[model samples]
Target: MTWNIAHTAFPAEHRRFRAVVGGVDPDAIYRAVHEAGGFRSWDEPSRDLLHLRSTAIEVYRVGDRWVLAVNGPSVEAVREVLRLLGLGADRDVQELKGA
Candidate 1:
């Protein structure tokens, strides 16, 4: 299975991989990311934006789906975060594979 991913126009020193997440609680995902040596570098629950440093990831809710953005374009990092969220490998997508 493949998740939808988008590349933002926002410029940074490195690339960001934005992957769509489904069938998961945002709060649970936040806790999981935190427990996995990730710190809440930025968060605005009112706007559904959460950014995790060290882990270099961000998750934001858009309509019915959640978008997971990984700084530095790390597929393994994305996969690891999904795993931490209790999502199986079947949820893996390659939009960020070569980006």
Candidate 2:
């Protein structure tokens, strides 16, 4: 499946980059994130919900999509996680302003 990642610059306390990712299997993505050294910060199996965070990024499910928030202004870290999550080299990324 093609992944659509819409990212924006959101400067907040420890949150610099934010993105919405579509067309992903939450279960597989969770595994990928976990394997990539991300810790489970939140989990609610009754609702099929979870949140994973590493040193630089946090990933969580929202509806049918996954939301990725970078802890700092580390664009490379974002790309790395997406790669680990199985996004192809040819990725569909939409850069937004004030999103």
Candidate 3:
């Protein structure tokens, strides 16, 4: 399996982070976020703060990729979420060898 990960910083929004992952399984990403206590439902209302964590993260499907947005109080918090999700600044597609 091959996947692409990209990161974008929202400077206007206090440097909030948005990670766009493409060419991967959206369901897998959704499950990971759900297990990490993040919001997975799209029907929920959007607010200034949605999740309980200070670094509020939301995972949703967009086309063939999963868009993970982190809205936190600080850049460190947002980066931490990205790290936890295994998404880095590298946008190159990665391939799995065995599986």
Candidate 4:
């Protein structure tokens, strides 16, 4: 399955990244995140929250897509989470200003 990374909002605190991933099962993604460690159950029924250092990652499913919202004090921390999610190689990430 191919994963298409869409726009990534900057100002890092916005910490939002969107992707159109198909053919891949969402359960596989959840398993990967959980096995990667530091993931805790989110109060939201279908969301998983991961804390990495000073960064926080929120993973949720939206329709046929997946959204990753990250909140942190630094851009690097946010990028680190993206990398951990195997999304670092996505070259189409448009950095939205004031996001």
Candidate 5:
């Protein structure tokens, strides 16, 4: 699923993390997400998600802006993501495109 994650800075709290649940090359997507800066991948995760939790990167923070580039048709999966991350309607999640 495609996500346009924007905040005022980079995310710090690990449990508050979000990630990709798609069928694309996450390695390449990982590289692309931070090209403009504001995010970085964590070498360790509290748990594993398809071997990606460890390598999954942080795209942005609550004080800045970043984005999640879904490799394929996981577009409708963003809500599940937010739920997984514990982010509620309280936080401002701006969907940049139409699914």
Candidate 6:
């Protein structure tokens, strides 16, 4: 289903992979990114943090840009979760895949 999350997050921009992540909380952000599709591989600046187990997921940068995912789990139950996160959106039949 297509959650209206795009509107709440990026009122100025249409729905896109980056907008969702950019709007959501940073906590477990890596997982969100991972679930989306792909992610960046953390480098030296993050090497020390890895030893501390502080980050959620591994990341790496590409050409001075970090790797990112464009795919995440379905919008199923997304409405509630997004609201819990203080985002404005709605889930509906249209959001469901192969409905």
How many clashes in each candidate? 0, 0, 0, 1, 11, 11
All models: lDDT?
A: 0.57, 0.52, 0.50, 0.56, 0.34, 0.33
lDDT of 6 at 16: 17
Q: Alpha carbon lDDT of residue 56, candidate 3? A: 59
TM-score of each: 0.54, 0.51, 0.44, 0.50, 0.24, 0.24
Candidate 1: worst-modelled 10 consecutive residues by lDDT: 46-55
lDDT of 1 by residue, 37-93 (tens): 566656686234444543455567677776665443556666666666576535544
Most lDDT-accurate candidate: 1
Q: How big is the positional error of residue 19 in model 6, measured in Å on the Cα after superposition?
A: 9.4
Q: Which stretches in model 6 have alpha-carbon errors above 4 Å? A: 1-76, 91-99
- Over the stretch 1-99, how does candidate 3's per-residue lDDT look in tens digits? 989888977555333344344444445555556667776435432212225356655555565555555555655665555565667634332222322
Per-residue lDDT tens digits for candidate 4, residues 30-93, read 5656666756556365566666556566667677665666555555656665666666635233
Task: Kindly report the root-mean-square deviation of model 1 from the true structure over all alpha carbons.
Answer: 12.3
- The regions of model 1 sitting more than 4 angstroms off are 1-18, 47-55, 64-72, 96-99
TM-score of 4: 0.50
Candidate 2 yields a Cα-based lDDT of 0.52
In candidate 4 the C-alpha lDDT for residue 12 amounts to 35
Candidates 3 and 6 compared: the better one by lDDT is 3
lDDT of 6 by residue, 1-99 (tens): 876654445344332111132323333444444454434455464221111111123233445544322222334334333333343445231222332
Q: Which window of 10 residues has the lowest lDDT sum in candidate 4?
A: 16-25
* lDDT, residue 61, candidate 6: 43
Model 3 lDDT vs. the true structure?
0.50
